[model samples]
Target: MSNGVIVRRGRYYWHLSVQALYDGKTACIDWRSLLPLNGGTTKQRQSLLASSKGLLIALVESPRDHRGERLAHSTVLNWVHDLRRLIRWMTSKDVWSFSDLRVTDIVDYMTFSTMRKDGGGEVAPHTLYMRGKLLHEMWEVRHQYPSPLLIDSTHWILKRRDDGDAVRRGGHLTSQLLFPCSVPR
Candidate 1:
């Protein structure tokens, strides 16, 4: 089948295709419609869009899980959502390329994700944990991305503090050392 063509198996179409059958009707999700890519400059936007597409496609093609099972289509879609948020945040911080990201930026992103959208309160602990875990998964597959993150995300830690708040350590910090409580907002 062609790149954008929907692959059908009886009434259902493959979820990885650009189009799928829903309720016996065709539903299209064009490749260009995937990422918002709204906040960056033209060059940055192009680069990000290309890189993001490459990463998603790579993940779809490879079973990087420990059990070597293909990721569920919903999981890949959730990663797309997470990537959109991360890309927007990175653009705001003048980080166009994943390779340009630093450990401090990663820490800042972790902190930024904890807040409620309406400024009411922090997000649920599980929500924060899931987001962090997703990020770790992406980091593990960084090399598969066309533009990979250079920072060693494995060195950093995402753990709950004694007070039950999420804590992120810098890549340079060891498990015995804690980041100072005053992480810049």
Candidate 2:
């Protein structure tokens, strides 16, 4: 498993395509052009999943944000947590690799996370929504949208359900604080 993009050589496809370094020069070859010479067979399906190293590796390796400045530790930690949770859940389902994950798995996780903390009660909508958002962020490499590490391109378009995400807990909740005179004292 690699971390760049899909590369198909003849008929085999590679999920990650490393850059080339030769003659003291690194050529920017199209990742798709640099595919596996073996024409990916069942033996290579295991390789279909992105490397098991986890998104943390890609995050740490990215190091900088869009501005080329270092990302905050908290941001990094959030990414790590998301990746850890996803990996743990995936492993439990016998999915040992990231690419092995199907869109259904994510849908299932999202549905499960929204379940009530108790038996029949629901957590705050924000809690549920945020988890989906955070999980979505883990797919990226170098802050790229839709991530470079997916086996199914359709997953890039996947979105969480919008029903529970109302504007409940933002600053607007303090309408009175913004206008003290409006208080019905």
Best by lDDT: 1
lDDT of 1: 0.60
Which residues of candidate 2, in runs, are more than 4 Å off?
1-54, 60-68, 116-121, 142-185
Residues 1-185 of candidate 2: C-alpha lDDT, one tens digit per residue: 13233233223222233334323432221223222333444443344233423344455455443544433334544444455555555555656545455666665665666666476876565555556655554554524422233533223333334432343543211110011232121
Model 1: how far residue 36 lies from native, Å: 6.1
CA lDDT of each prediction against the hidden true structure:
0.60, 0.43
- Going through the candidates in the order shown, the clash numbers are 0, 1
Give RMSD (Å) of candidate 2 vs. truth.
15.3
Tens digit of lDDT per residue, candidate 1, span 1-185? 22323244222123443324333554333444433546667887678767776666555655554643434445656666677678778877878887788777878787888886689898776566656766666677787787777665533446533332323332221121124455433
Q: Which lDDT value does model 1 have at 162?
A: 35
Residue 129 local lDDT, model 2: 50
- Output the worst ten-in-a-row residue range by lDDT, candidate 1: 169-178
- Please list the residue runs of candidate 1 whose C-alpha ends up more than 4 Å from where it truly belongs after superposition: 1-39, 64-70, 160-185
